[model samples]
Structures are given as C-alpha cells and as structure tokens.
Target: MRERPKIKDIAERAGVSVATVSRALSDSALVTAETRQRILDLARELNYRPNVSARSLRTRRSMSVLLVVRDVGNPFYLDILKGVEATAREAGYSVLMGNTESDPARETEYFNMLRDGHADGMILMTGKLPPAGGWSHLPVVVALEMIEGAGLPHVQVDNIGAAREAVEHLISIGHRRIAHISGPLPELMSLHRREGYREAMRNAGLDVPESYEVRGNYLLESGQECCRKLFTLPEPPTALFVANDEMAYGAAYELRRMGHDVPGDVSVVGFDDLYLSKAFYPPLTTVSQPRAEIGHVAMELLLKILSGAEIDCDEPIILPTVLHIRGSTAPPRQ
Candidate 1:
C-alpha cells in the first residue's frame, strides 16, 4: 500500500515550518497569503490529508457543523443548503444535515449529536429547540424561523410585514374578498404571516370573516384541501395569499381542476418565490425570500458563537422580502 503523506512532508517540500503549514491548512489569518498558497500547493502535490480524528481529539472539536431543518424535501431549502455548504467549506469546516420532519424525537437525536461532539455547532431551521436542557451552552443559530422565548440568534425575513405586502398587493388588484391559507398555527412564521394577512385586511376596511382563514400544514395536500373549502363558500374569495410556494402551486392546481381560470377567475399570491413558481402554468405572484442569504447569515452567526464571539440575542437578524409581480395576479374582472 502506498503510504499517505504527512504535514511534515508538505512543510519540508514547501520549505516552511510545520507550524506555518498548520496555520495555512487551518486557514488562519495569521499566515501570509503567499506562503499559505505555496504550502497549500505543495500539500496538494504530495496528496497530504489532515488527520481529522487526531485534530478533534486534541482540540475537542469535530470541525463540522450540523443543520437541522424541518423538511429536507422542500425546494425552498435548497438555496439555503447551498449557502451553508459553501460558507462552511470556505471556513475549512464540514456540514452535516438533519431532516426532522417536525418530529421531536428526530430533533432531539440531532441535538444529542451536537452534545456528543459530532458537530461543533448547529443551525436550526426547525424553529423548535431541543427538549433537553443542556443545549443552551452549545452554539446554535436559528434560521428562516423564530422560536418564541428561546433567545437564540435568529436569521429570517420579516414574515409578518412580507405577508402584509402580499395581501396588500392582492387588494391593490381590486381583490376585496381575499382569503389566506396559512401554515400550521404552532409555527412562529405561520402566526406572523397570518397576523400580517389580518392586518392588511383590517387596514383596507375589508372584513375578514371567520371563514376566510384556513390552516395548512405547509404541504400541497393541505393547500388543495384549503382551497376546496374556500371555494365552497357562497361568496368565495377572488384572491388567495398562500403561505408558501408549494401550497400556492397546489391551490392553483386545485383551482384549475374546479374549472377556475387562474388570474382571470381568482388571482393568486404565494410566499417563498421558489424556483418552480415561475414555471407553473402562470408565474406566481409571490413574496421572494432571501433564502441563501438567510442560510449564510445563520451559519455565520453559528460560527461566531463557536468562536466565542458575543452576539446580542435581543436583536434578531431580519432580512427583507420582495413581492415579485407575476402573471398569477391581476385586477379582478368587473
């Protein structure tokens, strides 16, 4: 078997001290850029790999971060994942992903992994903290959603204000009877969005009847079912503000199945302006979230915490949202 090259070999070949090679490999700012590059090139030429296990045992760090999200299948999370992986790799760290599917047991298992030093820190998109009490001391950053009372560093858009803007757009298009299909009530983002919807209606002097609000599980089936229920009303809503793009797609699909012309019969608006939203029959008018930026900022915050940097938990990082006017929304027919 061919022997693996060690750091000493790279240092000797690059004509640098072992300490300089170590600093360069770890991407330390202390290392001169030119010297670092030379050492890196020689290391690559020698096919040298760092002893990660030895480093972990010595430093008490796994040199990896974990990201726990609620639904890994959602396309909306793809951009976020990309941002996380990119940033982590640049920082000389690895990322481990966990999909909790809203299951507490799964979430707890991931938290346990963090505690066991499998990861140096965690970025949570699940919006729920671990049931275990020891996690407070561990480095964690919440992303794309907020957890009430957790006092953790969070990265997300202003969901309430964004939802209000979406609903307000529907109203601007002469949609007086606007209905909202919200995400599950337990989720903080869902509640913020629902509140935004109601606020917009109240500001416009539009009466939001009890029947206008429906709870969706942030799933396509729930969106379809909610739309069906809304359409059954004697005076159905002419515009819909769905909580997310997937639900918006489902709502549009169900609308067509029931003989409704997309923007002609009922203008539709969605959140999360996912990549597929533009390719749907009619492009969806929706709120565009900075998904990748949110992920990047969240991971950055987690890295800061892991480095013992102080973060003000009182002020959460809130990114802005834009309303993309697309073909799915138009002025209601007279």
Candidate 2:
C-alpha cells in the first residue's frame, strides 16, 4: 500500500522549506499568495491530508461543527443537513449531528460537547435556548426556527409572512371558512404561523370560531386528529392551513378516509415543502422555505464567529419563502 502523503513530501516536491509549506497550508498572511497557491496545488495533487488530531492539539480547535436538531428522524431536516455538510466540507471542516430528540438532557449533553472542544461551534436547530449562564462565549447560530430573546445569530424564514401568504392563497380561492392546524403553540414558529393565519382571517373579515383552529404537534398523527376535530364542527371549515407538510399529509390522508375529495370538498395548504410533498397523493400545496440554504447560511455564520469575526446577533438573517400551488388546493366549493 502507498504510504499516506504528508506535508513533508509536499514541502520537498514544491521546492520550499517545510516551515514555508506549513505556513502556506494554514494560509497564514505571512506566506505570499503565489507561494501559498503553489503549496496548496502540490498538496492537492499528492492527496496530502492534514493531521487534524495533531493540529487540534496545537490550535485547540476540533475543526468540526455540531448541528443539533430537535428530531433527526424528521424528513424536514434532510435538506438542511445536506446544506450544512456541503458548506462545512468546502471550509475543511467536518460536521457532528447532535440529535437531541427534543430532550433537554440530550441538548445539554451536546452543549457540553461544544464547551469541551469536541466541536468548534454549533448550529442549533432544536429551537430552544441554552442554559442561561456560561454560553455567552460559545459560537452558536440558530437555524430554521427562532428563539425569541435568545440573542443568538439566526438564519430563518418569515414564519408569519409565509403563513399569512399561505392562508391568503386559500382566501383568494374563495375559502372563507378556513381553519388552521398549528404546531405546538409553545413554539415560536407555531405562534408566528398561527398569528399569520389569524391576521389573514381578520383581514378578510372572516370570523374564526374557536373550533376552527386546532393545535397540532407538527406530526402526521396530530394532523389526522386535528382534521377529525375540525370536520366535526357545526360548520366545518372549507379549507385548512397546516403549519408543516407532515401534518398536511396527515390532514389530506384523513380527508380521503372521511370521503372528501381534496380541493373539491376542502382545500389544504402546508408550510415547509418537504421532498415528499411533491410526490404525496394530490401533491400538497405548501410554502417552500430555502431549507438547505438555511443550513448553509447558518453554517457560514458560525464559521464567521469561529474565525473571530464579530457578528451582530441583534438581528436575524431572514430568508424568503415561495408558495407552491399544487393539486391539493383550488377554488373552494361554495
């Protein structure tokens, strides 16, 4: 077997001193750009990989970032994971996925990893704030979801605006008796989306009877249960605006089970157009946020923080959302 290529070999082949090669590999400003490029080119040609463990001992950086997700099993997180992984690799960093499963204990365990230098930084998708003290110095970025008053850098979408637009789409198609299936009310995203739903309803002069809104856990089961409750109302809703695609799938599934044709008997809209949304039965109409972009941008922001750049955490970086009109929605039957 060929011996692993080393910086020593690149140094000899590039006709530079080992010290110069070292500086060049690190991209230290002390090395001229021309010399750095030459060394880098030679390293690439030789497949000369850096000894990360040795470098970590010298620099005290694990050179990996942690991505803490509320639930790694959720399909919604897949795109974001791709984005994060891609960006991290380009920057010569590896990623650690911390699946907290929404458990405070697991979250704290991952937080300890960051504090202990197992990872250089963290991109938080758990939608929860860290413990109050000793976290002021950690490099952390929040993604996809927001934590109000957390004072951390964020990469998220306009939940309220996106949700309002979704509901507005239903209203445009003559859906007056519109109901909402929301994520857990305690979540800020859910609250913002629910607010958007209410705002659109209020704007259209529609009375949202208490029965028209149901709290769901952003799961298919909750969507099914919520849909059952809503249809039992004295005046069933003509349409539904679900907070996430999973719940929307559940809602649509239940609608079929109850002998209703989607968009003919009732229209439905969902947020976060997961990959499955396009292939699901009737192809759900939903709001599509830049899920992967959210991960990419969040990782970039964390990298900036890790590089000692002073990032202002005061305001979040908000991305846009697109409302994809699909077969699940249309003009509501009068």
Candidate 3:
C-alpha cells in the first residue's frame, strides 16, 4: 500500500527538474542556493534520504574501502585494520574486510567485487594478490606486501632490512653460528626477510650452510619441527633467527622441552613483534613495526585517490622497524 519516494518525487514536490534536484543534493555548483534550499526543504518535508547505492552508481563510487588480507585471525593484521578503520571513519567512509587466506581464487573474487564497484578503494595486505594478468583493472588503491610487477600503490616496512637487523643484532652479540627458520617458498614477504638474513650472514663472512637453514610454513608446528631438525645438525647453531614471532614462540618452547636453555644453549631472535612476544616467560626480543600506521597511511592514500586527487603510484612508504632488546637474545655461550 506504500511506495518509497524517488528523486523524481522530490523534484516534483520542489517544482524543479530531476537534474536540478540531483545537482542540489550532490551540492554541485550548477544548482543555485535558492533551488538547493527549496529542494532540501521539500526533501526534509517528505522525509527523503538519498539512496546510497543508487547515488554510488551515478557517482561511480561506493564510499567504501576494502581491506584484503590473508588471515584475519592473525593479530598482526588487527593493528593494520584498526588503523584503516579509524582513518576511514574519520574521512566519512566505511570499510569492508576481506579474508583471502592466501588463496588466489579468493583474491580474485574480492577484486571482482571491487571492479564491480562494491568498494570505492582497496588496500591489499595479504599474499593473495593475483599473480599476473590481473593488473589491468584495479581499485583506486592497492596496498600489500610487495608484488613483483603489480603496479599498485602500497605502504610496507623494509622486510629485508628489518630481518637483517634482527640477524645482525645476534651476530654482533658473538653468535657466529646463526641459523635461519624461513617461511615457505615464493612468499614475497618471507623471501624478503630471508634475503635479509642471508645478507647478514654473508657480511659476517659466515657460510650459510644448508643445514643451518630450514623452510617453515610460518606456523607454530612448523617452527617446532624445524627446531628439532636444527638440533640434530652436527654443528648446531648457537642462535636462530626466526621469520615471525609466532613461529619463534613455538621454536623456543620446543627447545626448552628438549632440555635446551634458550639464550643459554640456543639464543633466538624473531620478527614482527606480536603482542604475546613481550608477555612470554622471557619476553621475546623482536622487531617492532608500526602496524597501525601502515594501515592508516594506506587508507589515507586511497581516500586521496577516491577524491580524484593525483597520487604517485610508484612511490613506496616504507616504515622503519625497531629492535626491542629483551631476554631472548644474549652473547653466545662461551
């Protein structure tokens, strides 16, 4: 028995053309103040509110931002999401979270949603960006771990430098036999961090032996398994440089279970200082990244692009990392 009023209804009531009503509602300069006021009054009298979806189609924007990540459960991503959420909200925009779980198919699905105009902009913080042939059509902003050739704006920490810093810190503490627990192959972020480890080893004139490094899946179990393998080495490393804090925790736990004293028998350093790192029994010494700031800046850049402002797509804002010295690291046992 009732129908929702359309722009046409407002136009009819305001004694103005549909185009004038549209311009007035959008606050375009084409509509005079008198006409805008008249339309506004009529619209309020009719209890009219502009249809967001319909207006989005007309303006080619949804006023929404998409945050694509691998695993939302990981606490590392939470800070970034919070930053994005706060900044986006302040800018009068909403955010949509997308979990791709490092799956190419799911990443493509989210991209499709953005391409179809479900979101005005996107910040990809996961490893799920389409490999190739998926760069042609993209959202207004793309922020993720470095993609080989994907031409999208992003903000990232210097993974290589940060990893190297952690390893080097151990080296400086007299750890000549430093081992590395790396993530799976082809994970750009992991690979970058691994490279940093390698660079540190080389600079120290130490041979990065095959036995001294192990490939991990960036999981707790992987760390435990790799630790066991490392322990069996004829010349076990005195210190281990783990890829992430989560894996480091597991490795250290396993080492203690195996009757090895951490920082006494085997020192360990980790990356991406997670919240639990500090509260653990011996407080993990790891690299502290500005997680929230990265997300905040990425969203800020996307908002600029959405507002039709020019942006330097090639420029990368790499934030610095801090090495928080804790009890997990010490001079290799003499």
What are the models' TM-scores? 0.87, 0.88, 0.82
Which window of 10 residues has the lowest lDDT sum in candidate 2?
22-31
- Which segments of model 2 are wrong by more than 4 Å? 1-48
| Range of the 10 consecutive residues with the lowest summed lDDT in candidate 3 | 135-144
lDDT, model 2, position 221:
97
List, residue by residue over 1-334, the lDDT tens digit for candidate 2: 9999887899899888998987776545567879988888888789888888888888888989999998888988888989999878755679988898778888889888999989999999878865655776789999977888887898999899999899999999888999999998788989999999999999999899998889998889999999999998888998999999999999999999999999799898999899898998788999998988998899878877775667888889999999999999989775
Error of 2 at 127 (Å): 0.8
User: Pairs clashing in candidate 1?
Assistant: none
Better of 1 and 3 by lDDT: 1
Candidate structures ordered by TM-score, highest first: 2, 1, 3
lDDT per residue (tens digit) for residues 16-134 in model 3: 89998876655455667799788877877887766766777777778688998877788888888999998887554688999887788898888888878788778887654665555
Residue pairs in steric clash, candidate 2? Answer: none
Per-residue CA lDDT of candidate 1, range 145-263, in tens? 78988878888889999999999999987899999999988789999999999999999999999999999988999999999999999999999999998899999999999999999
Against the reference, the lDDT scores of all candidates come to 0.89, 0.88, 0.82
Runs off by more than 4 Å, candidate 1: 1-51
